[model samples]
Target: MPGTTTLWRPTGPAELDLVAASGWREWPPRLPEQPIFYPVLNVDYAIKIARDWNVPHSGAGFVTEFDVDTDFVSRYPVQQAGGRDILELWVPAEELPEFNRHIVGTIRVTHTFPETA
Candidate 1:
């Protein structure tokens, strides 16, 4: 992991299932309406999205962490969506396969949020 940067992703159950289906090695292709595959730079931002957004909208949420080659990820500049900690990298959909190649290790589900009554 020396040459890699750790990244966190906020995932809904459907997407988490897909990642699991890949044996935790790859991210599924973006859907037609989805243009970019974004991974956040911080776990806190990832957790916020998973807890506040994905849970309400998707009924379940997850936070995943993985490492990507620093050189490959550096091609996309870090984007700050709102606040200082809201940082992410936006990889175009078409480049995702190549981006997947730069992933250094298996993805892990660090946290999971299930629907609550």
Candidate 2:
């Protein structure tokens, strides 16, 4: 079966800034307060997966993967909208099964960018 994918819409510029600064070193505080909502997977995971897949980095300090369809965003509408589409990150095949089993339909991953230096 094809893997599932999720669409993530960042809450705001602040959230985007947080992700850019941290590079997924840790989850940002702006993330929604709900266990069912799983914040975006660390960007480092994306970097590692891209390298493992032999994908080239654009030298932008960040990379995104897509078409694997292993992620799913919550259908719950945002209370207040307006944010940037930073990039679509993909989950690897090996990890997809685990994500499916544990996180696929149970949580919504929120994105929050921390303050920059």
Candidate 3:
């Protein structure tokens, strides 16, 4: 436990598909219209987005858990945007490898949600 580090990313089923296909090796790329990769500071926040926004709008959503290098905490400053606590990293498509470098362990699916409407 002493050497372990963990982080969470909540996403929709489509994104989770990409993650599974990647062997849990990468976070799915943001859409051309999306500008940032937001991994939040807590599971509750992730769940809020997954349920209130993702599942309803996208038909499905997920809550994922993974370990990130401890240094990641220091590398990016925590952000509170739109009144939510998140880590907002400007990870353009070209910079994905650099972003992946900070992720240290398996990206596992911890929870899944089905479309409610």
Candidate 4:
């Protein structure tokens, strides 16, 4: 793990299914309308989106964490989309295949929405 960085991605059930179908090794390619594949820098940011947005819109949500080769991911600069904590890397849709190849290990679900209430 020395040359790797961990990233989090908030995903819906459909995307999660695709990830599972990949044997949890890689992410699925983005759809034509999707222009970028974004992975957040922190767990808090990932949790917020998965709980507040994905659950509401897609009926379920999850926060996934994975490691990627640091050098490979360095190609894209970190993007601060909103608050100081809202940090993410935007990999162009076309480059996601290459991005997937850089994943260091299995993707894991760190959190899931709709907690017992």
Candidate number achieving the greatest TM-score relative to the actual structure: 1
RMSD of each: 1.0, 13.0, 2.6, 1.6
Which stretches of candidate 3 lie above 4 Å from their native place? 1-5, 84-93
What's the best-to-worst order under lDDT? Answer: 1, 4, 3, 2
Q: Candidate 4: global Cα-lDDT?
A: 0.94
Worst 10 residues of 3 by lDDT: 83-92
Clashing pairs in 3: none
lDDT of each: 0.95, 0.35, 0.73, 0.94
Candidate 4 lDDT tens digits, 4-105:
999999999999999999999899999989999999999999999999999988888899999999999999999999999999999999999899999998
Model 3's alpha-carbon lDDT is 0.73
Compare candidates 3 and 4 on TM-score and give the better one: 4
TM-score of 2: 0.25
Best candidate (score: lDDT) = 1
> Lowest summed lDDT over 10 consecutive residues: which window, candidate 4?
108-117
34-98 per-residue lDDT for model 1 (tens digits): 99999999999999999999999999999999999998899999999999999999999999999
